[model samples]
Target: MKHLFSLLTILFLLSCASKAQNSSKEKKTYKVEKTNAEWKELLSPMAYYVLREAGTERPFTSDLNKNYKKGIYVCAACKTPLYKSEHKYDSGSGWPSFDRAVKGNVELDVDYKIGYARTELKCNTCGGHLGHSFDDGPKTTGKRHCINGVALEFIPKEK
Candidate 1:
């Protein structure tokens, strides 16, 4: 019937428009650049794996999960300050959960590694894979930045 044909055409056009919108999202660029060899030499095995290879660390395995000190967490790769201790919290997800990150220090992108869309978080300066951010978080930001321990280094506050 012509009605059925017209409905199908409308659906097809809507799908195409949705795809175009998704693809138009901005991409992030980093300032620091290095070859794989250079990164490997500068980072530890676990840090390199999580930061460069987009690998996840075993939950509750990082000492940072238990750390409750006044400090700032920096990228293990480029030492860029990403999150502050005040924003860190226990999400019971086995990773270091932060309510937020320092503005302009982290970048977000979509990842489909697990057959689903996830907000992938990366260090803006080094372009290293930090982890993912979720909508389920505290009232402060309502954003949970789940970061890998191996991908971060805590710098104690200078008293």
Candidate 2:
């Protein structure tokens, strides 16, 4: 039975090492780093929650959901231009939806927060959480970038 015990111990150690490696890979390093205090000072309470803590805003509550004026939607944390106004759509999912993001401006990650895998979208500049993207979208892209409205600041196009 000594050989069986040895093999079991080896397997346990291997599993532990694999888990550590996976956890390390999951830690994200952002280009824009800020302390909690700095983020609190720079953002509204809701914005801080959604951007920093990956909290979701209440749906249909954001004025941006209905806003269709021509302009760019920028990251509330960093003012990086993210989504063009033309990509915005009424997904009726309560949150603002976009068909796509500006190239190289958004990062997609896998999220298993709800016991299933989801595509979590973040700002490439600040690494701030924007929302989730799904396969169910318009024919143009077939990808719904369901974004938290509180995480964005709209800059209307000048007349």
Candidate 3:
């Protein structure tokens, strides 16, 4: 009976491991799908780097950081509206900071690229890398979405 119990435990462990592996192998699908070549051609060099390759732009380099006009910020790659001007605020992070994104427009994922777990935010529509979200933010939302400016385009609110 003891030997049988041990064998059953081992089999259960193996089964659990197998399920974990399968889940990891599953890839996330996005609404706006595009070929790599198409993305490269459609976005500017820096935009492509940030959105497609998950690269970061230099701090304080994006004009959108200081933009205060009423507008909607859209994904530069797919034209999906991500954030509103009303949510934009200066977090002194030298990047465009927003307290929240448009509902259901941004998705969060875990990333360990920087040697620690970070809340990585992506455009839900295109799966484009937008930026990392942090907990240090104003009391309103307590979410600091530190986005790459190149990953977004501002559409000024029309009168």
Scored by TM-score, the top model is: 3
lDDT of 2: 0.95
TM-score-wise, the better of 1 and 2 is: 2
Ranked candidates (lDDT, high to low):
2, 3, 1
Q: In candidate 3, which residue pairs get closer than 3 Å at backbone N, Cα or C atoms, i.e. clash?
A: none
Taken over the whole model, the C-alpha lDDT of each candidate is: 0.94, 0.95, 0.94
* Residue 47 miss distance in model 2 (angstroms): 0.7
lDDT of residue 32 for candidate 3? 90
TM-score of each: 0.82, 0.87, 0.89
Which lDDT tens digits does candidate 2 get at residues 1-159?
Answer: 999999999999999999998877656777888889999999999999999999999998999999999999999999999999999999999999999999999999988988999999999989999999999999999999999999999999999
| Model 2 misplaced stretches (Cα beyond 4 Å) | 1-23
lDDT of 3 by residue, 74-135 (tens): 99999999999999999999899999999999999888888999999999999999999999
lDDT of 1 by residue, 59-154 (tens): 999999888899999999999999999999999999999999999999887899999999999999989999999999999989999999999999
RMSD of each: 5.3, 2.7, 2.4
